[model samples]
Target: MTLSSKLSAARAGLFRSLGLMFIAGFGATVAFDAWGQIVSPALGFANLSPHGLAKSLLGAYGLPNSDFAGYFVHFYLVGLIGYPLGWLFVFRPVWGRVVRRGGWLLGAAAYGFGLWILAIGGITALAGLPFFLNFTGITWVALVGHVLYGVVLVAVMRAFGGR
Candidate 1:
């Protein structure tokens, strides 16, 4: 294929893959939240919403209902929205690399390092609210959460590839 054709094909792949990922991620988040709302409440932690983290970090700037559910919904939506972006930085270059493998690591690194540490934390800090100080304690949980997100993305992508 010509350069233009190759670029167009790649763009198509990115769009198609991103759309699939977004739908899958959104469904997963909704299901997880459903379980939390229905089952977790019986266990404990009644205080929850779909915009928790966003509320925690940007709560002052926005409305209320600050908790995990809130954060999960917003987080999944925004994260999936950036799906195609992974292509440019992670999966774009592969022309007979001697290694012949490792896109998952590249993509996961972009997710964990770029989005998790830099984007998530940076956005929270940039929100410029006093509540951010509270995050210091549970920051590790949040970090691990993003790492898990990276793993989820890779796994989901592999599964989707099979279909």
Candidate 2:
């Protein structure tokens, strides 16, 4: 193939990965949100709800605190940060080389851990929030949510031809 054709292919691949990441990220966010709203509350975990993170992050930006604001910020994070992460890290080097060959679930599970670290450890620290939340139940719930997010993200991305 010509250089121009190769460049075109590369661009197409990038867009493809990005598109897959976008859809999968949204789905994962929905799953996490559902868990937070329904399951977490039933399980008596208050801090696991999305509102706290949304309120804190939006409040830092001088935005009015509301459920709508929180949900908006939550979706924005999932799309902008989470999706790109899956594209750059999970689907690129991690999935094909390590996960696909032997154990897809293991790889996806590991990706979930990475996501938790990025979201909880990195983002919380950046937002000046404590990494270890006061509510241990919330932390555990969040970890479980992140793992579920990773699994769903990988499955959706693969379904969308991200592999």
lDDT per residue for candidate 2 within 112-135, as digits (tens), equals 787777777766765568875643
**Whole-model lDDT per candidate:** 0.52, 0.72
Candidate 2 segments whose C-alpha is farther than 4 A from its true place? 43-47, 61-69, 79-87, 90-102
The RMSD of every model to the true structure, in order and in angstroms, is: 6.1, 3.1
Residue-wise C-alpha lDDT for candidate 1, range 1-163, written one tens digit per residue: 8999999999998788667677656544444345435544555534233255566545646756446545653655455555324533443343114345655655554455444555345666665633333555335444544455555655665677722
Clashes of 2: 0
TM-score of each: 0.53, 0.76
Clashing pairs in 2: none
Question: What total of clashing residue pairs does each candidate reach?
Answer: 9, 0
